[model samples]
Target: MATTPDDSSGQSTIDESASQVEILDADALADEPLPEDEAEPVDAVRPPGPSARQPAPLLPAMRPSSRPARSGDLLGYYLAEVRRYPLLDPEEEKELAIQYQDTGDPEAAQRLVTSNLRLVVKLAYQYHRQWANVLDLIQEGNVGLVEALSRYDPYRGIRFSSYAQYWIRAMILRFLMDNYRMVRLGSTRHGRKLFFQLQKERDHLIKQGIHPSTLALSKALNVPEQEVINVDQHLSAPAMSLDAPTSASGEGRPLNEVVGNDKAVNPEQDVARNELGEVFRAQLKTFETTLRDERERTIWHERLTASEPVSLTSLGKRYGVSKERIRQVEARMKRRLRDHLTRELGDEIPIYLEAPSD
Candidate 1:
């Protein structure tokens, strides 16, 4: 059906639509409200630049210098102090000693004692070789030094070291006598004096190209003849080695009924049999070594025996790896044993035992 267009109404509708699209009324949009609270302002982000050059800060209460104090230097300082004081000076030492005796001036006494520490140390060195530990000797010597200082008499007309020698040696010998049960050495005063003097006398005799005779020693050191011989016996006895071969005859058994070829055959057989045993033993040892190195025996003992096998997953968890690694280790150990056997024997090596047929 053909219909004729209404030209006047069409032109009015088109014109109205164009006017509605073009014109947006500000009065209508003003009724719409905004959000309730205002948004916070964002910080301006700067681009990253070169790191700032700041010097490393010093530690709190740390020494500024790099050098450290040395032990030898400290020892030298102590030794120098000891060398200045000769154990005692009559007037000054007497005053210090009286302060200790009368008023109980422990501080004065400690000062006196500390100044003489190196003297104790020097004397201690003489006994160092006798004792197992230098520290033990030094400690004993210190005790001896203290006793000497306590019992010292100014009127004795003797040097401190000279008087202290008896006390020091007494303490050292007492310690040795108590400890060394192998032989009860130098317990008595006479024996103790002889112990030191005998050595010096013997050394002197040797230097003079004469044998160390008991009568000569008795005359020189004023000791009895029997004591010198006893000490000499202890020193001269040679120590025996515990590892020497045991045999009564001192050699091999004698052959009285020995013939020519038959007797020679026995020795040859012995050598061949021994060599064969050695070869097998060495191979067995090598096999055991390879098994141990691969940890095959250890794994069998730990896991497949009476002891329960730990979970592979648990082992993997501990090591931060997969359970497959644990399995691979077991497989590699097995492979290594077969490869080692093949290498040791030959490529065509046969199994000694095989499974029975059904």
Candidate 2:
């Protein structure tokens, strides 16, 4: 019978068969050939070396793999292969982080980021349902992972996984917030909380048979009532393209055509106004011909009708008249012109041509 030693008890037991065992030289033992049935194929075995026992390096960064496959198949392959990268233990993680932090070594940083990529994928999976493309979320999370590695302090006594999770989730949420809709959902702290939690809280209230009013939601979620209403509307309303048909029949006009733009100038009204302006200018020219006094005509044409009307004092100096006298003459001329135009155009005279009431 064969016997074994007890390590814990510090005792050994021996059998007579143990004395017949043969010792072999290390080189001879390694060189010995195995039977055909027990031997590995020559092509399947690698030469013995220190590197043969080492693990393959993880990817330097998250990028599209160079494999010649469809994108979906490639992504699936990447996810499967990334999982095979061995996770770094606390000591290994700390050493790499410290090396990168102290010396700013790219190799150390690469190792630190690549080893923790599995963590980013795990976190990305949690947000997969909220986003359209899982790869986009994973890419965003990888960015967060790199950022976390840069800021990680090995002496903080917290695990790198714990620290990295916050950054990963933040980046994923930011991406979701930015791309989810054309209009942004939340811009304030309370608004952000309400945006992410309002649906869940509302569902809970509905399950309990309580009305999820704006006020009730505001109190439960600690957001303003108006903000709750605004975000709720945003979530409930799907974005509609302006080019989409406005009616159910699909033969109707596009929304962009149906919706009125108040700021747009009406073409018909613009043309009519332009024509009226021309007619008024003709009437003013006819009225200026009726002004028997050259001085009055000069005052009306140069001072009143000029694009930028001359100042009353300046007009008074140019015509060698007292300022008060110039003012009186300007008023009389404006009144006479208004009367003449009203008689000529009747109701068609533009309101702008009417005399200013003193």
Candidate 3:
């Protein structure tokens, strides 16, 4: 006797029985198609579904969105992402720095950079009031951070943050000096100090109920009074747009159009000055060579033509002559030069000599 399995729940369910045997004909089984779910055993390997079998997309179907275009929007995103990277403690920083320094491992360098991005952001924020584009400042500071990491000395007793702060602030300040205004701030050591600390010093003075004049600032900061005045003017001058309309008539005449081009070279004046200079130089050379007295020649070349003319007393001491003797020699030499120049170049000599005053 034979018993067939029952088909319930759309699947085959075998039943146990004693003394029951099931038989199948090979021709009948081969003629009928097996149901897909039924043909595969519970444990048998099966091909993936149609969705999975389809080709993968060329690009990710759900990639991370691009950063927004507006600065304000991007700033929020940057702050949130930067916060995700926790600051590194001294030990952690030292280890990563050492790893990078020894093996030049980029991954270790990356960890060091990511961990300290918050520090860059913090320093960049301090410069926020001074600059309009905070994001650009942060980007520059990040470059500084990378440089600091590359040059970091793990054996140094100082912490990485303290060391990195200098570079970070330096890069940001340099960027500001180069780009924050149409006119660049001076880069001399004293100029840089004044540029960076003038405002702070001024504020401190004001808080103390002291006037923040150039003299006061110069004394407080130990910078030259003129430098203090120059930096103060740079800080106070408002940025003017060249494209802005100049008048209420709405004629579209920009300030650039109305403003005189101070940089424009005066060809006429330049040519005249060049000709007069050549003439004066040739006549002066003749006069210098004609001088029979070596002392007079020395005084003429050393004292008169020097950019910072040496004092008469110094010249006299140098030549072991009295100051009165040196003055007389200089006067005679000047008269000879004036006469020679007048004879060679006529009225034009006075113009060139007088031009210096202007």
**Global lDDT scores for all candidate models:** 0.40, 0.51, 0.50
TM-score of each candidate?
Answer: 0.32, 0.42, 0.40
Find the candidate with the highest TM-score and give its number: 2
Off by over 4 Å in 3: 1-72, 186-193, 196-212, 215-230, 233-358
* Models, CA RMSD each: 47.8, 32.9, 32.9
* Poorest lDDT segment (10 consecutive residues) of candidate 3: 349-358
What is residue 185's positional error in candidate 2, in angstroms?
Answer: 5.1
The TM-score measured for candidate 2 stands at: 0.42
lDDT of 2 by residue, 199-309 (tens): 657766886899989899899887778878766665431111133332324433333222211122233233222322334444555677788687787676555554344
Q: What is the lDDT of residue 96 in candidate 1?
A: 70
lDDT winner = 2
Cα lDDT tens digits, model 1, 230-328, are 665543211111111111222211111100011122221332223222322333334545565434554433332212455667656666767777566
- Candidate 2, run of 10 with poorest lDDT: 39-48
Angstrom error at residue 25, model 1: 99
For candidate 3, give the lDDT of residue 73: 46
Q: Per-residue CA lDDT of candidate 3, range 123-218, in tens? A: 665555566445556666765665566556777444566555555665766666665332254445575566546665676688699998889999
Q: What lDDT score goes with residue 178 in model 3?
A: 60
Cα misplacement distance, residue 296 of candidate 2 (Å): 89
